[model samples]
Target: MKKRRFWTRKQWCSGILLAFFLAAQTFVLSGCGNDPAATSQEESDNLVIATSFYPMYIMVLNVTQDIPGVEAVNVTGTVTGCLHDYQLTTNDLKKIHKAQILVVNGAHMESFLDQVIAQQPELKIVDASEGIELIEDNHHEKNAHIWVSISLAMEQVQNIADQLAATDPNNAQGYQSNAQNYIRKLEELKSEMHAQLDSLEDRNIVTFHEAFPYFAQEFGLNIVATVEREPGSEPVAAELKETIDIIRQSGVRAIFVEPQYSTKAAETIATETGAQVYTLDPAVTGPEEPEAYIEIMNRNLQVLLEALGS
Candidate 1:
């Protein structure tokens, strides 16, 4: 109890060495716990789905709603209209590269698809219009504006859900359930539209462009004439006169124009033919909400009723 033991120099040095080694080990463990690579790895585990444009983006939103660990994004952000001659930006490429899947409205809608496939050969693609019959444009190219038709849009929705389920088996049930719920809403809208439109005597309409052939076909409305064969290309004097003549001859009372394009041509034709101008949205672009498509279609139905209802 009275004697105090002193440590040898060797023992002291060994103790110091052991303390240093323990401290270094602790520092290394803490550093690894906060590594940025670990965080990046966690983020990479998420299933990212990228859509080609606005319409497909909305479809994916409906299909993947509330599915955990699934992120849906659009390649083209806030694009105001159809992708007729759309060019991809570097940002778009980056988004596509980071995604695990790319959903597109097929049937030649995306003119840049070949370039995309060449660039990203490993990317999985889901074509929404894979099985739907497409209307041909004047140039004999398949019209890719299938989503404008509610019935056709419903089919596209189902196609998307099926492909998504096949691609991501872990969330298959969720995708199918969400698609069924959305399709039911679409069915209700279609029934309502048919009930109102089927009995109209004046079914003849003149459209601003060729965007509404599918829409006209869906409701049995005859497109007597079109103001423009292609969007953004105003009709020359001769074509305008011819369209006016056709509208007058067919007794077409309404000229339908898309919200995405200028209404100057439609207004000119309406003035010349005494037909009223109305907005019929193709839903190529609109609010970035989950229910934007349904809402836009509802508005279009009202517009049709006003323009066509006697």
Candidate 2:
């Protein structure tokens, strides 16, 4: 039997057509019951984000709301509780593991964040406090609560927007727009606070903690004394005596107590100096009602002006 010679052009064309048909059949059978589009949709919907504190959380929420298919979760709860004293639960750690983006004030502010960052080396962490001028605290670092000043807070909001936009480029435009609008409101708040406190020209103010130093520095209010000689510690007897002397000598109009601690110390000073006790929430803790950063600052100014007889 003689072996057949190679096929001619017509036979070659028929062989190519058969090969193409076989490949098409294999592809259809391989994906007979699969939906790639649905798989993609499900994957896109799994993004989760978390912020460390109330102020940070609020700013993140404002920006993330406009970004489609993204959900923001705040790991820390409530405003009234001390951040340093905050205890993270197992659920908090789960959120940490699931988060794609973690926005925090900074290491100096939220020390608790250090552990989270250590555990999740791959997590994208946005330090909102970066690049802003921080007050130096020789003991460890300076005041961690920079949100007290509206001007500083405006910068913080901008930084947060930039980080979020960088992480989620698809929604960059929305983040920028939202940030601009928020900054404008903050500037307005700054002006309103200035106007509100302007009339009370020569009043002396006293606070329970040195937390209001930035606020005093910003508004030019005379902080004659702070009840707690130190930032986050109880007042010593000598410190208490000195504060009382300052109140009496300077003719201080009011004693401002923080809602985080007992008002009894301030109340006692108020009684001795004939000055009424006024509550100025540092916003380190949460508020009784709807107290955003700006709202809390506005309320503080109102209370200060009223107590000072401006």
Candidate 3:
């Protein structure tokens, strides 16, 4: 018999922020906080932490890898892919069983999380998305792709580290140190991106999906419109007509498209409105590729500035 789809509704509503929880369905979990480390002195076996995607995996690895007996494995793969369509095999289940701490962004981002948890509830599951406010999906009540902005990303990592340390007291100090170092880097990145954004003359741009709200908010960019009505849905005829009108009326400079999705729709828009179409990868793929999250984000800033003629 074929395996059942593992995504469940109960697993969808966890996370610390809107940005992290919204993308709780997609990849990338973000946040920032100054609360004292909320860790406990519990002991565990091997610290095997599995993540839904690259960003979460990065947060876990940076914190726990330096310590002995702690191992962080990212099951998201090396390509720019999404967790929504991901399927788990027997090998994945075996890995999950071996993990002492399962660190996931949250329930909504990977509906498959429910099945994984159901099979191994004893696993010390840490929802990095806890405590953050959630952005409601206009269509669905739950929003799952929250890690798009640097501000939110920082918040998520801090919380994840705290939870990991608390769950595994043996490595509390390591987790804390890692979290601090990573936080500093994230702050610097956010500052640099903001500075670049400040220089932009035009903040109006269109995108294939509504994935850059945090970035747009950070840089004060006006996302005049998106091609896709919702996270995964294609544009309807009426909506396409409306988008075309909005592009024409708003004088949008360029349309941003993610590599994971087809550019056909964006191409049509560009062809019709004369706006340049730029490609952006949200960094689902690991650092194995040069154009990982940070690089892609920096490149995106440059593309936006050049396209907008900032």
> How high is each candidate's TM-score?
0.84, 0.78, 0.78
Q: Compared with the true structure, what per-residue lDDT tens digits does model 3 show for residues 146-176?
A: 6677777778888888898776665678888
Clash total of candidate 2:
5
Point out the higher-scoring one by TM-score: 1 or 2.
1
Model 3: residues >4 Å from true position, as ranges? 1-45, 140-142, 230-234, 288-292
Instruction: Compose the digit string of candidate 2's lDDT tens values, residues 67-148.
Output: 5555577787664544755667788876776566788887376786788789878678888888877665446557767777
Q: Give the TM-score of candidate 1.
A: 0.84
Whichever of 1 and 3 has more lDDT, that candidate is 1
Q: Give the TM-score of candidate 2.
A: 0.78
Worst 10 residues of 3 by lDDT: 27-36
Per-residue lDDT of candidate 1, residues 145-262 (tens digit)? 8888999889989999999888777678889999999999889999998988899888888877777889889999998888888787788999999999998888889998888788
**Backbone clash count for every predicted candidate, in the order shown:** 0, 5, 36
Evaluated at residue 90, the lDDT of candidate 3 is 69
Candidate 2: C-alpha RMSD after superposition: 14.5
